[model samples]
Target chain A: MSPRPETAAGPAQGRPRVKRFARAEHRVHRATAALMAVCVATAACLYLPFLAQLVGRRALMVTLHEWSGILLPVPLLLGLASRALRADLTRLNRFGPHDRRWLRSVLRRRGGRPAGKFNAGQKLYAAWLAGAVLVMTGTGLLMWFTHLAPLVWRTGATFVHDWLALSLLIVIGGHIWMAYRDPESRAGLRTGSVDAAWARREHPLWTPEDGKGGRGEEE
Target chain B: MTKDENPARPAGHDDDRRGTPVGRRVVLGMLAAGAAGVAAAPYLQRAYDETLGAAAQNDPTGLSGLLPAGGGFRYYSVTGSVPDKDEHSYRLTVDGLVRHRASYRLADLRALPQTRLVRDVQCVTGWRVPHTAFEGVRLATLLDAAGVRPEAKAVRFTCFDGAYSESLTLEQARRHDVLIALRMQDRPLGHDHGGPVRLYVAPMYFYKSAKWLSGITVTDHVQPGYWEQLGYDVDAWVGRSNGRDDVPTT
Candidate 1:
């Protein structure tokens, strides 16, 4: 069999057109992440009281808490409803043999490309967060509008909302650290594109140069 | 829960980070957070003073608004957006049962008649804001307008958010004092207090005060909304239900 085209440099043409996400898609994702963080922080501010001795203003904390609820979810809804994100998510969620090979190399320190367009961890995080945001919206709506249910339902939803928020926060804390600490990961989000070298180094399998991806423009 | 084998303890938070050793940043960071928390204590105390402090003053009617001594209304919105509508554009609809099927804008209702009642606004969550001023269209007035049917046993209420739904027993809906509130403390409902129109049941826990209320459907029998189906007492009267033996709702 012939060697793969990706294993070699681009065929004498100019730099291949990069498969960059649209500007709006990047804007929405970053906005949602920031808003979600605000919501979690405000929620912590309000919950700290019941968890311990009161830590902040009940009214002020409550006021901030309420606004955060409205503020945080707007960006998420904007992102989810976007046609671009929905499509990008489909590719991001897929798992394939290339993914497995990448995993082994990671485990063994053997020298093939890093797994798939994204390692399993990144895919799992994206999918799980999507589900989490959806759940939070549903349960949160039930809570804010207590009259929609009998008294018991409202109370229970409130309890669940708080617990889920706490758990999500712990996970999100790690996500932020990973994105910020890893220079390559943060670059993709900051500029709707990543340096070819950076992409090859972190997600070698995803690099168009690999020609591993059968799908048109993106590898 | 896991125990912290080496929990960081701080002393009064007076230390300044000048030429602090880089190696001790983690400990210093913890100290900073603790100090900030202490700094926020006064605001928490102030909020309690505004709420429970008012309740302690002179809530004779045992209503849900702030006492005269407390100085303001401070009902909380977990998500914080309440309609707080003005009289000119406000509207309340009663549908889902009977033949009359009508919609009354804020003006039409205000013109019909008004009733005022003051009662305690106790929350199942534990805090009680007392003697709140509630005034508006009594349930009896609206129920009469729609003309309840023999088959109807409950009324389902939906809000602007489109997710929350609440139900009221036919009997409860007809209570002479049960109201669809237009005003609280002589002013229109504000954003924080379930503005525009919220249910004002003087004798029940505060959850019954559904904020941003939009739709009302008369049903054959009691079908609990989000909360009731989950397990909160359908008849959440203060101290009367919800398995808690705390102060009475009224």
Candidate 2:
């Protein structure tokens, strides 16, 4: 009687035939991430039309916004399923106690506090992004299927859809500036993996705990 | 519009963190979800089939509407939630200012001469599902049965769903591609996609194609349909409105 090699895997080990991040994975994420940015921002641009009044640019804003959203899930799904993107997101989602302190200090405007894994700002941003994306998807579908929902629901959905898009743009704008301003951070997603020293310096709590979602710390 | 305002970038914290290598399980789970959507297509089609009749052709209703704005067309019910397939439960009525008011059964509609059409089904949302086949009684036939008063210059569409409504000008209502669809994709109407009876307007966006269609009332003037009242175009000529610049598909 022999122990089969394929059957040898345990519940704890997880699926090995599946892969983690690879170089090509990084390339895919870079491209997809760029695309995702375009759509979410475009959605934000439409915010003014909804919040105030539907003006000249409002129509263009809305069309671009929707098209962008429709296209966004493509990258997200691709990235999530992608070995590289999964690895990237997994690492980003991780968390630790230092992240807690980061939140506390930021609240106090206390500068230069060393944080573990993703800081509070990063976690909040990630969580907001995840929630907004889901909301957008749901409302977009409602907008898509006119007969599926009532008029009131569609109106409300459209209202929230537009405002959330605006808020996303504002927040995402700040994020991009911070990234581009800081070369090290921007380099990470652009090239797939980040520099080793960059990781340890900022993400002291960084670890590949699989499902711990440590990188972004539960965001 | 600002250069610094790039919404597409990854929203990291004020500081940065390094991502650990990913686990294999996450990848497998995502793959499974993808495979499921693909595998479910056939069963979904069957289920879709069981619910609604075809859209006149194997394609969308838009193809039929593409008939030169003055052509003939058809639409059908295609959902499980529709009222009923036969004449027993169907109700085709004409309300508003009309000299000859009446309600007809499904058998009554079949008794009338039917027309057929082929067109491209376009969505105001920017997607165009092409080459739809539709079969239905000409709206003119229905309008004649309902009888129009001189004051009437509009028509309103009400569906069994009661959630959606649409309006057309007297002229628009008289167009040929506009049909009270009895069949779609050449099958009996289904319920999920608005079966038993749905309106098919070729060349216009699908929203103009109301599902669960139940009522047709001739009125005084143009009134916006369900989606049109909610930031959608009532006319919905492909690539003309709904904020997109998509090229019109014939």
Candidate 3:
């Protein structure tokens, strides 16, 4: 595929735009984010003594936290029906030579190597979070259904669930901080599109000529 | 208060026993050995109850209560450490809207015909210890002995644990399954399990089974318990109230 010119102009500003995320991708991201927010907020209310006392609807909080966590994977699973999302997920799964270079540059605090649709850091975060969520769900189910396992297993599940949840909260905070630092990435997530210039500058290797970029032409 | 009073001992026996330290090394050793099979050793469970569980009871933050101890039950106290009540000092009082107000010591309670129930203990927060055995005098038996007045519609339970109370309608209180649980898991209830006595409401969530039970007062209406006052359902029936659907413990 050759690098194609952006056809759809940005809303109001009229800057040329390229599709960075599919509608399914955007919706999945948003749904997951919303559920994650509920989980974190309810977890805080349940775990923090001051918060638990201040917001004393603990039963409600427990229900909300459990259901939100159980439902966290639904959006991504449903989004897999979309070919665009599936393709993006494949791209996220693979780490090329450029990704290793990008990681090295990140560690060195220097300019990053040319990147594709997702950078090495983004890939690692996505992969780590997916594993964390899966482990949490397994451990959470064990904690909830205490009879399904022995006492030691249940105790261990609770231990892992509590600690992993704390780590998830911290990692999510960093994810939000990074997202806040990058307006283009945040806008792409919000609107399913990005300025063609921003895409070319930040993810040069993702341009259509490389065959791994998001839709270079506006969809 | 009772015909069986022993005048030799002081009344404040429970007060004197609060915060009595258990040997930490002995408890730690048992904990390590018990880690292999916690459910198998009742003595280890008792050691944990007297040490870590007792210490946790005094923790104002209640975080330590979340630590997995006492076999399966979590340690929860609304107030700091509860005073220890033993066979000699422990007394259960039955009053309020009753024809015969009475006080019974541990022996008096144990002398009554005992009922043993094996049922799942379910917590509203979603933990279940299945097929657990609790043996004690029936709450109904006590209510009947007290001769509840016609106007009395409910029974309020008070705990020596301090700041914890629970209530059940007279009908619910009289259920054959409801017990003034003196023994759990085929052993005399440990301190951490709300011994020397506790209420075991078999059909309801575990919170309804108030621990360290000391007083039973027949009342005119349902008074919300400690957790209920903090927004837990007053009628915390398993698989029914609290928006939960766990298999009924009954």
Candidate 3 C-alpha lDDT tens digits along B1-250: 0112345656632121122112222333333432333333345445666788667657886667445431245445555457889988899999999999999999999999999999988986555676899999999999999999999999999988667899999999999999999999999998778899999999999999998999999999999998898677888889887656778988
- In model 1 chain A, where is the ten-residue run with the lowest total lDDT? A210-219
lDDT of 1 by residue, A1-219 (tens): 122234222323343334445555667767876677667766655544332123423345545656666666576466666554554555455555555566677678886744544665675566666556655665677656656765544544554455457667778988988876665445455444544655566665553433221122221
Candidate 3 residue-wise lDDT, A93-118, digit = tens:
66667777888998898976767777
Model 2: per-residue Cα lDDT over B133-249, one tens digit each: 778888877787767899988889988755578887888778888888887778865654466777887757777778777888887888887557656777777767664444564
**Candidate achieving the largest lDDT:** 3
Candidate 3 DockQ category?
incorrect
Worst 10-residue lDDT window, candidate 2 chain B: B66-75
Model 1: lDDT to the true structure: 0.60
- Worst 10-residue lDDT window for candidate 3 chain B reads B14-23
Per-candidate local distance difference test: 0.60, 0.58, 0.74
